[model samples]
Target: MKRRTKIVVLGSALLLTAGAASAATASEAPSPRGAAVSEAPRPHEAAAPETDRPREAAALTGTAKLHRSAGDDITFSFDAHLAAKDKADPMKATGTFAFSHYQNGDGARAEVAVDCLLTGGKVAVVSGIVTESDLPGVEGKRVGVTVHDLGRHDRLGYSWAATGTPAEMDGLPKCVSSAPFEKVAKGTGDFTVVPWQPEF
Candidate 1:
């Protein structure tokens, strides 16, 4: 069954790769009780025309954990090292990414809203131009900007930027491929993500 899930997922990814050309929409993946995974933007924010500050999506409200095993040789634990498993922001100037296959993200949604180029965990000042990639196949490709934390640091969060802000930040660089992720999920399973893995 596990292998089959892999096969199914990989097949879907390939199809989605080409299908993404005109995919136009995203699907909603349900989560445990309070948190719900979403492929589309909220009615209000989605309604807004442009991407602005790093606002938490109402669709995004919950706790998360990213970890590695004690016996493992890897460095960070799920809480300290989670992959930005899936990312999409209508805020993105180009394309929308649908996140699937998230593994240990218990009780929280696996996506967030950030300027395609901007990637900051918390922001001190909005002075520099943080760069980031944009959602593809759209009006703007991936410009650069900065992601400012909502000022509430007790709860962890992320912001997007098109350019790089040289401020003091804790968020790891976005790992679009084989690098270690920084979110937590529900399990003892090791999270090994590649550019092609569905998520989870």
Candidate 2:
């Protein structure tokens, strides 16, 4: 064949091959825009099993002792003066704590509280309050913690109410970045007294 004729034949062959490949791609289903939808596994591995949930926590010894003065016209030895930047806090008063298996993810919490009777613009009588609950994987044991309602005066009142465990403080302080005395400038810098920790 002539040189020019050979060149024409080669180009035609290339075009035919390209056309066939395009036709094949067009016949396939188009993938949606997001992650490829993969079916859940047979056992479904995302949500934790209902039975896997931890049982209530067991009772333990806990305390909340403050080492500073707050402006509440009521200062107790353990009356917490915290200033939480995140989550709803319920420390309405002040004192020590030791609680377990908190319920009401954002409503109720586990804790122990204590304070002295208000006297001379300060609390003078030390008393205690405790919240009780059970721990997961543990039975016949009741855990408690002392709590103060710091959220009483909050305009945005408590929103972050979760349980905590003293063993590891599972998800307590880390829920928000703060100390026990984030509210009281007088004692905030020098004092520290918290109420509870999330369960394990």
Per-residue CA lDDT of candidate 1, range 1-200, in tens? 23322110110011022223553566655666875553566688664444654332211111223232422111111111112323343222222221212223211111122232223333111111222212222122211112122322112212222121112233433322111223233342232211211213
Which window of ten consecutive residues has the lowest lDDT sum in model 1? Answer: 6-15
Per TM-score, the best of the predicted structures is 1
Residue by residue across 22-107, what tens digits does model 2's lDDT show?
42343535556785874555766555876887432211111222222321121112232322221123332243433111112211
TM-scores of the candidates are: 0.17, 0.17
For every candidate in turn, the CA RMSD to the true structure comes to 21.8, 31.1
Find the candidate with the highest lDDT and give its number.
2
lDDT of 1: 0.23
- Clashes, model 1: 47
lDDT of each: 0.23, 0.25
Model 1, runs deviating above 4 Å: 1-67, 70-92, 97-106, 118-200
Regions of candidate 2 where Cα sits further than 4 Å from its true position: 1-108, 111-131, 134-165, 168-180, 184-200
